[model samples]
Target: MSKIKIVTDSIANLTDEEIKVYDVHIVNLNVLVDGVSYIDSDEKIAKETFYQVLKEAKELPKTSQPSIGTFLDVYDSFEDGTEIISIHVASSLSGTASAAQQAGDLSKNHVTVIDSEFADRGQAYQVIEAAKLAQAGASKEEILEKIKDVKEKTTLYISVFSLDNLVRGGRVSRAKGLLSNLLNVKVIFEFKDGVLTPMQKGRGSKSIQKFLDEQVYPKLETLTVKECSLSYVCLTEFLHEQIDKLKSMFQEQVLHIGFTVPTVCIHTGEGAFAMMYYHD
Candidate 1:
């Protein structure tokens, strides 16, 4: 039987337990702040500390995809004849997928690269599924087909309380950010076809919840939800409250919570929350 290995990037938002259980290999991205660089790993800089620093920083940090050399190093670490399935965040979101492809072309071992077309937990779902299938002694073709099916069924919804980070990162204009703050407007975005597009805007948290209830829940009812995960930049009473509500609502589905990665935080800022679900 041929050995299969699962590879993903830090943006997957996988937990330590999940990483250990699945034996997933992660390649870290470079986060530059105040002219200093840090790896996007818990060992290098904790997520809590990163958020605190981001809250105080004068300018938003810049993130760079892992180098092809980094990918090559990981690919070369495994023994010969090992088959690799390298899953990554959306190509439209980052160049990590392209870097993986470049390294795969240069690798000696058999390598298959996949663009998850999602980020955070949405991407993690595909990685975990592929890892599980590989661990079960499934063939490479079977695992790849499962991943492709999951990618097609995944849905990502994100809501941000503040647009400061987006404005600083140039994703949103300063004037619009200020206006949103003044009006207490919360904007929800949906990741579709590998692009993050604005879905709706509400006046406040209450209105946001109303939007979710009216728009999101109905759509979810139409699909056969298999798995769901929630991720947030910071933990708050509101977050806990929402989680409790979701847990009660989706009792049959697998539900989990995770902290957002630094790269995502750099764009959404604090008080950002996202819900990702996979369905058929």
Candidate 2:
């Protein structure tokens, strides 16, 4: 009988303990700053240094998905009869999933690729579920079904205080970014269907806090939340308050708080934070 192995991209934001406990293989993406290319994995770079470099850079750092050759090397490393389940970030977010799929097609071993339709901890939720099911000797179909369930139940939201980085990345027009900065505009986004949809647009940090009080906490109380992850570029005063509230609501034991992926930082800029939940 062939055993199953799990593969995922760097954007999952999985901790070292979880990666080791689950024996997950990570293929990392790259961020090119000036002429230097840095691997965007926790194993490769320190979070403080990565965020600092992003802040100091004169222009937007260019990011690239892992090459197909990298995925092929990982898949081919496994012996024959090994079942490989390659899970990755949303296809709309990056080309990592596409590269994995291309490698799956070319590899001699059997490889199954899945796009989690999410990123950061949201993607991590699905990847971890797949690893757990694989370890229990579950069939591919069973693993797929559970992954589908997790995807349906998991949710991600981001709060941004500025649009400077988005304008630098050409994702937002300079005029809008400038106007937002002058007006102190804040935006909340819901990551749904592999796209970041603007859920609320209001002025100042109070709008962000109001949204959390009136929107997020009430909803979580009604559901059984399995786990929650907090990702941010900086720990602002607002984030500290939110953290206290989260601990009060869900208990600190169930929370994993850390820096988000570098790609996420590049777009959201400083004073941006994300909340991801995996609920029943």
Candidate 3:
């Protein structure tokens, strides 16, 4: 057994093999689509079904974080001597972090709760790394140090193709958002300081591509990114082009691509894609 155990929420977007190989534990978040609930597993069938149902639904899908009792249950399951690092999605985005912290306090084990301040693959970067270090017998201090280093080096950028969801989620004004959607306005955001700060907006998907071409590609060209992922609510022709372009940048590692979680889709709407990468 590893010296330390790893725990994270379903928002991390980890693969089944990644979880099995690294021995990471997950707490699920419930996503309700048209009154039917589905636990996020980052699986293809769930994503396909969810999105298809999403397209015809009259209301936006709702997502809820795991309860504090759930976290306490997982924490108490570990032996008293077991050290756990519980990493979760951004507190700014969900209450999962608070729940973990509350549970960590109540648990008898030594639990270190961390707010990853990211979603999907961004949070997975931290969870996976900590799991790796623990598996290799690294101390808690060393794992925490490495996690902090990676957090600082990480960058998450996103493009929203429609403003409808944001409007529905109350992130944007309904009238203005509806107008923007009708006009085909695309917005690009950089997730920084635990917030999705808008970087640029213009008409058409070209704006998204241009922003990436100018703002992100140069950085990728210079940095040694250990992980790269492109997560999306819906894939388009433009997304395929971006995927091909990003694949060209990585010499050895494969670019990780998957669906963005409901926490993000609530804000980005359909056809939104996020780019996340971190340097050493």
Candidate 4:
């Protein structure tokens, strides 16, 4: 009968309402633009402005993972006898999970840190699943097992229209990204075990969607997707129309669509859309 707490980083693109509804605690990731660093404040820097700054700014905007101290501070705030399960972004992409683990090691109480191997909505899906299982009175071990099962069946489908952001974000070598672009080959990046790895290359959006439909959708079937949650994170609101088309195709599935946070958009730039579906 121990109380359990859920934690995650801001890059998960979790809405404030969702955080409250799920009773999840979020650690803010630092955003730096033009040598100015600040915590992500929804009330202050809007997602659009954050993305705009990245697009227009002279220098590349950078991101920092929450420190071990930040995690320790949050761990200290929990009530006595509380258990914590912190689900974080992919360890390959960010050091936030490692920082959380380091903090957990310092805590006297029970704390389980999870490396989601994905970012943005993909990470959010894992957090949501963990929250549901924890609220159902599942033990830390049981919840972690469930998270692993769900993560294995999860799918990340992304399409990048431009390589500028990828190069700036250090996702791809500048020469390679530029050469691929010159060949009219758009790349599909997959988040696996916490890194943005290339899955396939397509000629255009239609080809990318077809690749997901053919290559990625089958994986979701292996996990029995009836209890799954599907999320869409786009760099710009203009991509909503495309999302609607995908939603229509899977009309029976419950889908959650939202714009990616400033932290993500800074790296993705415009005309980037990613879909993360968790099943099992």
Candidate 5:
């Protein structure tokens, strides 16, 4: 019945208040613009300013996972022998998860490091569930079982209204990306086994939202929403507003609405929205 700690990186896209409420340990990721590097969720730079720099930059910003020293600091602060679970974004997409695992190995205490195989709310959602289970006196084995059960239920849906950002971010081929932009091919993307894969393509922003509402949500709704949370991590207020409306319709259930941070927004583009749900 002893307490177990939960740790995750900022790329999980969890908000400050949520982290505080869950008593979670958060490691910050670094976002470099031009030559200067800033922590992804630093309080010094408001999210709007961070996004402005990202939007207007002549060159795309570079991101780096938290250094081993940063992880060491977090690991050393907690009591020794405590069972710490550090979860992070997919290793395929970023080195954060791998770095965390390395840090865990160096930890003097017992650490359960997870690759998460997810990002944004998908990763954050698992941390939230694990924290709750740990708080309820669940053993580490029980908590990890819960994490694995929910991992499969965790889904990420990203809508990209502009391929320009993807091209700039090197996520797509310049020629094909530009052509897709010229063709007005708004992409509906989803994460499959930690890879960003396009699920559907449409002509405009409205069509993309329709795809989310009509096709995406319907399929996701079939899964149980027990203790599930929803999040809106995007570049535009309009996209947040749209998800807010969708969240309102499901008010009968308890769900946390998480905001996207610069860490996630940088890759997803300027007019993108992502919805994450967990059936755990």
Candidate 6:
């Protein structure tokens, strides 16, 4: 039997405990803040510190995908004849998946690259599920099939409180951002079909929560939730309150929470919160 290994990039928002438990190999992305670059690792920038710096910085940070060489290095670390599964963020959002494929072509070992079509904890769900299958003596093909199923069944919903980061990152126009801020608009987005599409906009958290209650909760109630996770740009009283509400709602399910990665924070801004889940 061939040994199998799992690989994912930092944009997955995997925790240290999850990484250690799953033995997942992580390739750190690069974040440049005011022209200073830092590797996106828990030991290096830490999630909280990244958000703190982001809040204080005058310029928005830029993210770069791992290079082909980085992927090759990770591939070479495994023994010969090992089968590696490399999962990454959406190709529409980043080129990391394409770079991993290029490295796999050059590697001597058999490598399968999967574009997860998700980011943050949405991508993390696919990686963790794949790792679970790999540990259970499943073949590479079986694990790949499991990933495809998870991708289809998974859903991600995010709420952004401010558009400052989006405007700074050139994702939103400054004029529209200002208008949104003036009106206290909160935007809700859904990650589906490999893209982040706006679902609705509300004037405050109450209205946003109302949207989720009306649109999100009903859908979740119909499925058997296997796993769920939350990622936030910065922890706030409102976030804590929301988490409590989620815990009460998902009493029978497990929920994980952690700070969002710098790459994601660059677009959502501070006070952004997202919920990602995989269901049967």
The C-alpha RMSD of each candidate to the native structure, in angstroms, is: 2.2, 1.8, 1.9, 2.9, 2.5, 2.0
How big is the positional error of residue 105 in model 5, measured in Å on the Cα after superposition?
A: 1.7
lDDT of 2 by residue, 98-211 (tens): 999999999988899999999999999989898998888899999999999999999899888889887777656799789888988898889987887777777888888888
Task: Residues 1-280, candidate 6: write the lDDT tens digits.
Answer: 3289999999998888889999899999898888888888745567876778887777778889899999999999999999999999998788899999999999989899999999998899889989988888898889999999989988998889998887877666799889989999998888886776778887888877787779877777787888777899899887887688768767644787778888888889888988888888
Q: Model 2 residue 214 lDDT?
A: 89
lDDT of 5 by residue, 199-263 (tens): 88868776777776788668666766654444443336666666576676566445655456776
Cα deviation of 182, candidate 2, in Å: 3.8
Worst 10 residues of 3 by lDDT: 42-51
Residue 250, candidate 1: Cα error in Å is 3.6
Which candidate number has the best TM-score? 2
The lDDT per prediction is 0.87, 0.86, 0.85, 0.75, 0.75, 0.86
Better by TM-score, candidate 3 or 2:
2
Q: What's the TM-score of every candidate structure?
A: 0.91, 0.94, 0.93, 0.87, 0.88, 0.93
Candidate 6: 10-residue stretch with minimal lDDT:
245-254
Candidate 4, 36-61: lDDT as tens digits: 88786554557645655766778877
TM-score of 5: 0.88
Query: What is the C-alpha local distance difference test score of candidate 5?
Result: 0.75
Which runs of model 3 end up more than 4 angstroms from their true locations?
Answer: 42-45, 172-179
Error of 3 at 185 (Å): 1.2
- Per residue, candidate 3 scores C-alpha lDDT tens digits across 1-280 of 8859999998898888999999999999887767777676645326544556577777788888888999999999988889999999998888999999999999999999999988888899999999999999999999999889888988998788888887777666799788887887898888875787889888988888888898889989898789889998888899999888988888546589877766566667778888999888
lDDT of 1: 0.87
Give the Å shift of residue 64 in candidate 3. Answer: 0.5
Please rank every candidate by TM-score, starting with the best: 2, 3, 6, 1, 5, 4
